[model samples]
Target: MKLRTLLAVFGVALALTGFTLVAAPGLASTITLDEAVLVFVGLLGVLQGVRVAIARSRTAYEQVETPDPEASQDLPTPGDEFDEMLATAGADRREREMRESVRNRLERAAVATIVRTEGCTEAEAKRRLESGEWTDDPYARAFFTGSVEGASLFDRIDLRRDNQSRYHRWAVHAASEITRRSEGFDA
Candidate 1:
């Protein structure tokens, strides 16, 4: 039965029992069977409501209100050691090779970005890129067609004003270079 209905029934039974006990002098002196049952049922309804309230309280407490300790501790920040690794890798590579690799990575990053934004899989994004379906897409056109000249493809893609933003620009530039090289353009 619904909680409200059960509560209403319990209240009515209790009220009737109380009225009966008050009217009868003999019943007022001693607890009757009907009065006992009504009290028990009312207590049970109250207990049920308390139980539901407690359960709901616990569920609310366990919800995503607090930040996860592991998540907060483990996730890399903008100025983390990972940035050093990327810088070292870039520095280690010859200028020509580095440029090509960066271009390839950027292209892949662009595809990944589109896939994430469009809610598509990596495979779908790759197909779109390979098939030239992204020629009309503003992001794709900007990255691929060299539409925005002088600013390096990286700069265009790194719209965010942060450390990772610089990395994004570099990635785009690298990917563009890789694409050009693959198409037999001089490095």
Candidate 2:
């Protein structure tokens, strides 16, 4: 027999032996061997039925339970396509916004140098603006910060180059300016 079946049989035998031992000595009740066997089988059947019923009830209760969507939806579901799509879209939107913000900042920086050279071509002025040489230039940080407007040096470079160069140059210039200002130096 399988281990579980053997265990069940042993359990029943132990239960019958315990009951016989506990019976009162004055009560001379005679149960036939067949009747004792039948009673043990009946008890085993009842125990098995009770176990199955308890298991079925537990399964039914779990199946009927519904979780609140608001509480559960925030967590990522494993292997769920819709959840993955939403997460990807959110990431893409954030990246695009960051790129746009950088472009706007560069444009602002380019517009600030207009006053110094009235007739200067936008291309030449942008080159001058992006070159690392002008990082100390007073208008550089203001350009990125959106404080300066109208014909800044950034307008001189071609729009594409202007964006690339301005992003790099402005970042450096802005950092330096921040450090300078922090130390109470005017930049």
Candidate achieving the largest lDDT: 1
Clash totals for all candidate models: 6, 10
Q: Residue by residue across 65-127, what tens digits does model 1's lDDT show?
A: 776576445677753453444465455544556445544655676576556555678888777
- The collision pairs in model 1 are 102-174, 102-175, 103-174, 103-175, 104-175, 154-169
Model 2's alpha-carbon lDDT is: 0.50
Error of 2 at 154 (Å): 99
Question: Which pairs clash in model 2?
Answer: 110-152, 110-154, 111-152, 112-152, 113-152, 114-151, 122-156, 123-156, 126-156, 126-157
Best by TM-score: 1
List TM-scores for all candidates, in order. Answer: 0.26, 0.23
**Model 2 bad stretches (over 4 Å):** 1-13, 16-19, 22-29, 60-187
- Cα RMSD for candidate 2? 17.0
Residue 29, candidate 2: C-alpha displacement in angstroms: 6.0
* lDDT values, one for every candidate: 0.58, 0.50
